[model samples]
Target: AQSVTQPDIHITVSEGASLELRCNYSYGATPYLFWYVQSPGQGLQLLLKYFSGDTLVQGIKGFEAEFKRSQSSFNLRKPSVHWSDAAEYFCAVGHGSGNTGKLIFGQGTTLQVKP
Candidate 1:
């Protein structure tokens, strides 16, 4: 079965420190990779995505993700963190089919920013 796992349930980073959220997927073929961020009392926002072509894809809010086929990982990274960046991050995988909206989400990782 295809699934996504976010090893860390919670992560803390300094306000100006770099951040990386790990995401690994188990699938027979290369699936669509996506990263979403949801703030308190808000809907999920698309951070970045990898849908073929480029291994490294740039996303909104100074975020970027690299797709590694060998490791079956699509990790999200940021050079610097902000207080407003603190939110729940989710890694999702979508099987290439009729609907791209259908995705399997990971448990989710909550990011806490320190002063």
Candidate 2:
């Protein structure tokens, strides 16, 4: 079955530290990959997405991800994490053809920022 997996269920990082969240997808073809962040009470926000073209895609909030077709992975990265970055991060893959806007999301990774 095709699904998304976030190896780490939770992660703790100090403020100003670099962060990297791993995301792997199992699929027949290269599907649309996305990274979303959900704050305490805020809705899910799109951090970045990769469809085609450049492998390294830049996103909002100083976030970026690289699409590795060979490994079927789209890892999210940040140079420095702020306290406000504490929240839940999800990795999702969009359906192909018939299902246009539908997305299959991973369990999610909880981020705990340490001051």
List RMSD in Å for every model shown: 1.3, 1.0
Residue 49 displacement in candidate 2 (angstroms): 0.8
Q: What is the per-residue lDDT of model 1 for residues 1-115, given as tens digits with 9 covering 90 to 100? A: 8789999999999999999999999977669999999999999999988889989999999999999999999999999999999999999999787666689999999999999
Q: Per-residue lDDT of 15-71 in model 2, one digit per residue for the tens?
A: 999999999999876699999999988999999988889999999999999999999
Which stretches in model 1 have alpha-carbon errors above 4 Å? 98-101
lDDT of 2: 0.94
Task: Tell me the TM-score of model 2.
Answer: 0.95
